[model samples]
Every structure is written in C-alpha cells, then in structure tokens.
Target: MTLYPATLLLHLVGVIGLFIALSLEVAVVSRLRVAKTTTQVHEWLTLSRVIDVLLPVSAVVILISGLVLTFSAWGWGHAWIELSLGLLVLLGLLGPVINGPRMKAIRVAAQAAPEGSISPALRQAIFHPVLRVYVPIPGLVALGAVIMMVLKLDWL
Candidate 1:
C-alpha cells in the first residue's frame, strides 16, 4: 500500500537479474569444456552479448534501488544492510576486474585463432583459475546477502 512494497519489488527484480547473469556465465562456460570447432567457440562467445548488458545494467539498478531503500525506509545503521552493502561493493569489483577480463581473454582467443584452429590452450584459458573462482563468487555472495536479510543478524 506504500512505496516500500514497490521498491521492494524492484529490488527483487534486480537481484533476479543479477543472479540470472551469473548463472548463465556458469552454464555457458561449463558447456565450453565440451565445445569443439571454432564456429562453436564463436557461438559460445556470442553468449556474452546477452551477459555483457545484463550484468552491469542489473547491478546499477540494484545499487540505485538499494540506496533508495536504505535511505528512505531501512535505516543506514542496520547490521544486515551494512553487510549487504559491503557485499555489494565486493560484487561490483568482481565483475569488472575478475570475471570481465577472463571473458575478454576467451573472446580474444576465440577471435585470434585461425579458422577451425581452436586449441587446447585457448580452452584452458577460458577455464582459467580466475574464472573458475570468479564464477561462483557472485552467486555465493548473493546467497549470503539473502541469508543475512532473512536472519537479520546483528553486526559483529
């Protein structure tokens, strides 16, 4: 019956969008392990077009909406909010420096290889340590944030 409910709904949408992007990254890249043929690599890389826009846009929306929810109704001092905001900062960093570069490396390799010359090293780069670690970080943090919201834990 008030702005809180609407804002809450929007916030949920952003969360869903953010998770969807992360999930897709995991799914598509996992599939890459079995992927063969340069054309197939190109197709897999094409999946990025969907993710590239979804992640940042959803992140921005979440950040803006969270600020609104924080200042308007949820007090800034709440333990859960502070922790969630801290997780958000970590989330913001993960996409750009960690995941983004891994994806770009894959893209560059996919583009650089001669036609039909998809190599094992190229695939290894795609499944690099950074990406393996990076993929789950967002989802795990989001789940942690959700747990804090549900439990409403106190600041420690």
Candidate 2:
C-alpha cells in the first residue's frame, strides 16, 4: 500500500500497455502495407482508434507514476530524476498534442478514401514527414530517459 509499490505497479502496467500499443501499431502498419484496396486499409484503420486512445493514456500513466517514483526517491533537485521526468512530460505532451492528431487525420483519410484512390504521392506527402520525425524523437527521448535513470548523474 506504500507509494513506492503503487508507483512501481503503475509503471509496470504502463510499460505493458505501451508494449501492446506498439505491437498493435506494427501489426496494423504491416497490414496497411499489404492491403491492396481501400476497404482493406480502412479495416486496418480501426486499429488506429485503439492506438490513439491507449498510447497517450499509457504514456500519461507511465509518466505520472515515474514522476511519483522519482520524487519519492530523489527530491526535486536530483538532476537525473528531473531529466527523466522532463522527458516523460515531453513524451506525454508531444504524443497527444502533436502526433496523435496527425495520426487521426491519416486514419480518417484512409478510411474515407475509396480503394486504390489514395495516390502514392499523396500517401507519401501525408505520412513521410511524420514518419521521419515522430519515430526518432521517441527513441532519443527513451534513451535519454534510461541513461538518466540508470546513471543518476549530476549532468545539470
């Protein structure tokens, strides 16, 4: 019933949720790639609803629980904890405010268009920029967060 145990449980559950969401994305993207018609792609688009909901919720839980753990362990002044907490905040905000809406647009477009009507040029135009940037930012932030948590250094 302690804060530590509760936070740990929430963090673990958040990670599990994130893992499931990521797996769903991979499966859905693969299905989208192989889809020959709009109906097939639209069918796959339904998965986006799950991702759109779960991803941010899991991220928020992970971040809030992580911040609870950090604050409990290392007061607010601790550089590593602060850095990890900051990255978590960034992920939560950016995922929802920026990427989430863009993804929703893409999904809506996919669902609304007729089979084979989504032009290759339009597809690339719609997705390439987001695909290029959104994925890499998370990896870098995750790496920074892990290093901050593990090292617990005074890099401030």
Best by TM-score: 1
Candidate 1 global Cα RMSD: 1.5
RMSD of candidate 2 to true structure, Å: 3.1
Per-model tally of clashing residue pairs: 0, 1
Residue 75, model 1: lDDT of 81
Lowest-sum lDDT 10-residue window in model 2:
119-128
Worst 10 residues of 1 by lDDT: 112-121
Write candidate 2's Cα lDDT for 1-156 as tens digits: 988998889987986787677667657655665666667767777877798788778888987888788768656777777777777777777766666665566676765666675756436534556654564466566657667666778754
Candidate 1, 17-83: lDDT as tens digits: 9899888888878876667777887887788788888988888888888889988997877888898
Residue pair clashes in candidate 1 = none
How does each model score on lDDT? Answer: 0.82, 0.69
